[model samples]
Target: MWAKRYLSLDASRPAWAYALDAIIANHTTKSAKAARPRTKINVFLQDWNANTTTRSGLPVYARNLLNTAKKHNLSLGAIKMDKNLKRKLPLWYHLGADKHLKKLNNTTISDCLREKHGVTTIASLQRALRGEGGCDAPIYGQESVRDNCTCTTCQDLRGRGCKHPRRCRQAADRLLHFILPKWNPEDATPGDGLTLTRRRKRRNQDMLETSEGDFVFDPSVTEKGELSEAFRVFVEEDTTRHPPALRPARGRVVHQGKPPVQLKTSSTVFNALRAWKSAQEQMVSAQLAQDKSATLKKR
Candidate 1:
């Protein structure tokens, strides 16, 4: 019965429209799980795909809506009513919803979709499916071979480097990647930034090595000074490049029953590595201190 109505939908309606209609039908029929918005969306996508020749995967479309709604505390009803979001949401749902939705309010999917489809619209979607090539279709507008576009909106997007919102929230991560010097975590530190990269077990080669990536530090955890010091250590390790003047003194480390080890005077690679480790530890400590103070204030 639902399939017949779905098939009867005017071919001109947008993809999201089809999704919305199916959801409403389920509610009217008192379908099990219709009370839960997420479940309704999931069931609607499933029924739509099974009945239609062109099937959008159930998981893909469901994830796109659920994850985005989660970030903004949006009800599924709100998304259905917002035409601007309706325009953006389908493309995100169609191509790369899961990747972009992992981060709260991430727009990587939307921006990249624009980069590929050149500002999608309902008409564009129909044209593309029919091989008519809408908006950014090569026969229509233009394509960006260089990952950029010439339109005013795209020009602004490119100028901002097309970085997603998640990148901006990652301070310690950016610091580890050597993209910036100062990162101030907005909240308590999560943990040490070091990641175990390689573990080698050979004759007397028991040493375990670690490395750092953007995920190593949660930006919500550190302060600006700590991030700067970590980035500074990254610059210091490059002996081929001249060292910046007035380097910070390396703290001493003492192993069980072993004499103290001085970080700065150690082998060039080891010196930088130790400095980075020290900075990571300090940043974590600073984060903990901040969290404690905030807790006290609340009390």
Candidate 2:
């Protein structure tokens, strides 16, 4: 009995001994599956100070997390901030940091956490707060290029204009289509709103009252260099002549894209438009009155 319990058993062992070995094997298999080892992720830093330094390499980890989330096409729940960061870190890092230390420069840190590398989670925060010593270089800044750096940060710093003409064209089309009806009601045909027609050039445009004076380049003029410049100048001049209620206040001069001019029809065209709208209102009022009188007579 002692040998059966203590010593290893072979195939020649008794049936009771075999049954005991089977039970032990089943328990060992269950334990192995239940307690499968997890792959541990290690965060290491040579000399990072959490209390003094602006960076803690947490941004690197945050960036990794963001990439992983994107690779798997997962949407992390909304960014949350731990409230204890203010007490843990210096006041400078807490600039614009909210009650829960959620934001930096009015942008949510959690948003940056998912989009770019930045101090995000508690682990990263601890790393930053506990960081001891490191150089004061920006963790991620404009990388040096041989010539004409095209990285977004460098391009923005250099005030590089948008090279993509399609985006500019789309924005221009949206504005032109939106303003075309207000500028010339005659040219607005019944069709999809995307379509527009430009008035043909008349023989003489000396008179301001004539159709020649009111000529605007056709929608196809956007494809022409000289005509497009002329159109742009006309738009800028006309919009600046009168301030519209909806026009946003001009602050700084932006060189790229279209200028912020709320271009509309010239004064003569606008006056005619106003008169036509007034006549429409009167016609609607007269129709309503006639219908009301007829209904009363029938009653």
Find the candidate with the highest TM-score and give its number.
Answer: 1
TM-score of candidate 1 versus the correct structure, residues matched by position: 0.19
lDDT of the candidates, in the order given: 0.33, 0.30
What alpha-carbon RMSD in Å does predicted model 1 have with respect to the real structure?
25.6
Residue-level lDDT of model 1, residues 1-299, one tens digit each, is 22323223235435765665554434332223323232223332222122211243334444454334333432222100112222222321221122223231124443433444343332333333222321241322233123333545444544555543222223212222221111111112223333234331231133223332222322221212211111111111122122123223357733343357754444888888899999999999999999999999999
**Candidate 2 pairs with clashing backbones:** 47-133, 48-131, 48-132, 49-131, 49-132, 50-128, 50-129, 50-131, 198-218
Candidate 1, pairs of clashing residues: 185-222, 187-220
lDDT of 1 at 32: 36
- Write the residue-wise lDDT of candidate 2 on 1-299 in tens digits: 22322222224545654443333223222213222121001111000111111232234433443334334433211111123321222221121222332112223322322123223333333332222122122232353232243444434423434332222222222222232221211222222222243223332333345544544533331121111111111133233222223223267833543347877679999999999999999999999999999999999
Residue 233 deviation, candidate 1, in Å?
65
